[model samples]
Target chain A: MSTAIALHAPIEAASRAARSAPAADAARADAMEATLRALVDAVPTATLLFDADQQVRYANPAARVLARLCAPDKADRPLAVVGDWHPELLNSGALHLCSMHGSWSGEVILGVGRGQHKILLLHLSRVGADLFGMTVRDITQDSMRESELHARNAELEVAYAKLQGAQEQVMQSEKLASIGQLAAGVAHEINNPIGYVNSNLSTLQRYISQLFSAIQSYEAALAGGAGATEAESIRRKLDLDFLVGDVPQLLSESREGIDRVCKIVRDLKDFARKERSEDWIKADIHRGLDSTLNIIWNELKYKAQIVKTFGELPPVECLPSELNQVFMNVLMNAGQAIRDQGIITVTTSVAGERVRVDIGDDGEGIPPDVLPRVFDPFFTTKPVGSGTGLGLAISYGIVSKHHGTIEVSSTPGQGTLLRIELPIAQPR
Target chain B: MYRILLVDDEPNILSALRRCLASIDVGELDGEALKVEAFTSPEQALERSEEQDFDLVVSDYRMPGMDGVEFLSAMMELQPAVPRMICSGYADRDAIIAAVNEVQLARFIGKPWVDEELAAAVVALLRPGSARARAPKALRAQAASARITRVEQDDDGAIVLRSDDPA
Candidate 1:
């Protein structure tokens, strides 16, 4: 009997221990809930918890402020109750992005009271089996900055276009002005010779007509029973024999002079023909150099001796007139650099797909520091009136347009060398 | 005698023309002797032209004050019957057009003029049948209309006409 009572007492003790353990577990759960609530309320950013149906279950102070901003009256209501809130948050099994707030997974917006527009970033995360936690932050300044950057980029593009247009206009005007100057010089030089040649021819024609009439008179007199002595006397008086012999020679000389003048005029016409728009063509570099030399011959002939070293070069595709301008500028500069009796050498060769041209002058070379900025617009070593400072700049632009390059090497006392490399064919 | 006035800017040209004209022997021919007077300046030539009626006038295209066309036009207004010719080295299309339209030039002689060609051109101008023909009033009006159309076509075609002055 004592053994049975001992066993029953142990069973009763086990039951009481079991009942006390459940009460301890319930107290622990309550303490955990209070700690979670305190943590949520203390956070800086807006934090909220929602049930599976998207109803707001708990909101910290920060979360209450955000809720009022996003949906004032719907702070404790289901998310769907807010008119502006995205319904996709409730429908989408996974988190959905809010485009208005620029957030990957939440419904965030400016508060109704703050009538001014603002930006907000929000994130929604699943917490438990039937709960979601959302965090929100304001980001109005960031969006505004992005918009301002876009506007600045557009303005910069417009300014760049205007700068490019102005540059092109200046280049074109410089080219035209140079051509006009050349044309004036050429016309003046050509007109002087033409004036005398015309007068000489006109006078020679009259003399010829008179001589023919005189010759016919002498023949008639000889036929009309005039004696040999009388005829001889008449011939000597009229200087008929001298006229007969010299008139034909004079005519021949006049004809030769006219032919020479005609040739020069024709050459002038051909050289000064109006150029078409810039277009690439297969051009012989040597021929182009020769033409440029002819055009600028008057300027260089007295100052320099030109030497040519032409190799078997392939034709290059380029704008012929533009290339001619470059040649003229370089050649003229070379001539001007010489004090007196200097040598200008032009050499050409072909390597692979490139045609290389070298123009070297035995004149004072460019200073080392100035060489670097030679292609800069309005940079000139020459006197102000003598140069517009656009020659090298224009040449550089022309070379670049042709998909070519120009380089210079110079020693102050020795000379300067300008090297140009142009592609034999245009790149596709 | 057909009196001709030859004007040039250069003294050498005037002297050469005088020598060549003085050497002519046209005594036996029924045609009158060609009398030539040379002047070194267009201004002097114009002065001489006002003093005497010249049968024909030849002038250089380029001069100091007035161009050949302008000088010739002035001469034409003074003596409408006188034939005018332009001898020039810079005889481009624009100059030629101006010569034809402005002065009604009788002939254009390119510089370093051949002796026979010059004589022929002068003879052609002096011929009785070659007297300046007064175009009908209607034809003159048509010419004006044609010039306008020509300019319009040139503008539409985007053709850049050469400048009037060769210089």
Candidate 2:
């Protein structure tokens, strides 16, 4: 603002001098012209003035340098026509547009010399009737920098997309690694029932064959007219009464074993199912918890007893398998915290529009210092190879994705409790 | 009577073991009929063991309250001369070593044990002055080979073999 006022000070002085005396007007005009010429000549922008006949009236020092570079052959001669300095500008019709519209501005390429060109920004304006003013600036380096920046941005976007893809793949591979770890406990769970059922089946086969042999002996006695006492002796010898009573018991036990095995298989199938796009379903939380418990029961059964105090719950809209993974992680941690016989209690309740699940374990509790960092990725208190440490971190992510919260409270040497609260219905 | 104590967390396992021992007679057991008492809880079995002496004790390795090794270690205090056996589907090497070195466990019986092998192990443990060798491997090789062929047909069996906890 101050610079504009200072530039107008000379012009104002000239105008005021003209009013004071007519005798000094010619001397003041020449002084004003010299001051204006020096100001225009000092600026880097090329400045040109033109008369109504389309002939160059004056060129600033910067404009003369540009004319010399544009047309070296005509450098010695006075620049009278616009085409001699820049044929592109003369062909652009900017002068005609400025005469009609009062002003025009554009960017153009000016061929300097020797097959090279410079990008130029041009501003043309009509000063008064039959007079025109124009300014030009070279912007070749600035435009090159802008294009280079654009290319770099595009490359960064592609790299960012690939990084996101790799992150998703890592999450999936971690899930698979956890499944491999659980396979040992699951195999133990299944093998127990299989063990008992196989043993019972073998015993039952022997008992049946014995009963069949007793029948054959009785048939022979009846067909050959043997004494009644002989058949009775044979029945007692075969322990027919014991076989009759125990066969049904064995059959029932075997049936229960097979049922338990089938349930384990189904729970495993549910646990290991691949995530799908349309995997969201309204599911019973209790059922998912029960199945997850069944899968990890082998790991927990020896050290802890599970106590479930489940209240009435409405169906929760969720990804069932992912939530199952969360439960498995928390429950497994609860089981591992115990050094001996302990109690793991899982309680659920609904308060307003949210459902709350609290898993508490009476075990060796977490230390106060380590409690806060439990959810950090790759943080572990367990021995190496026993845990990947992604369990709680992944659970935190899953719960957050459901727009829910998970918190833990622990008293050293007493127990630890983990509480998860989730909205019953997801927001659309 | 030759009193045998059986401990397993699963009721079905106890019942199956009882059936496998049902045919033992006085002649086979050196003039005494085999009397089997089964308990699902190791603590309860230990309480019972305190009340009466047992000729032999066979227990599952994994159980609530006390594992088979601990239970047998306590049983050794009650009846120092009695032999103890551990039966389990899980094959934790450290637990096995502890059972052998600390408890002086007489036998390690794998689950889905052949009925004849179980009966033989029990009889051998009970017999007077019998050389306390490991459970006899009479039908083990044949049975194991047969089971391996069927492992793929049974998904759990395949997993049991593939798992790091190998028997």
The best candidate by lDDT is 2
Q: What shift in Å separates residue A193 of candidate 1 from its native position after superposition?
A: 4.4
Extract clashing residue pairs from model 2. none
DockQ of 1: 0.17
Deviation in angstroms for A298 in model 1?
2.6
TM-score (second chain) of model 2: 0.76
The most accurate candidate by TM-score is: 2
Q: Interface RMSD in Å per candidate, to 1 decimal?
A: 6.6, 1.5
Query: Candidate 2 regions off by >4 Å?
Result: A1-162, A173-184, B23-32, B124-167
Tens-place lDDT per residue, model 1, B90-135, is 5355666677667776666655555444554455455533211322
lDDT of 1 by residue, A231-277 (tens): 68767766677667656655565565566457556544444444554
What's the residue-level lDDT of A46 in candidate 1? 65
Number of colliding residue pairs in each model:
2, 0
Query: TM per model?
Result: 0.50, 0.72
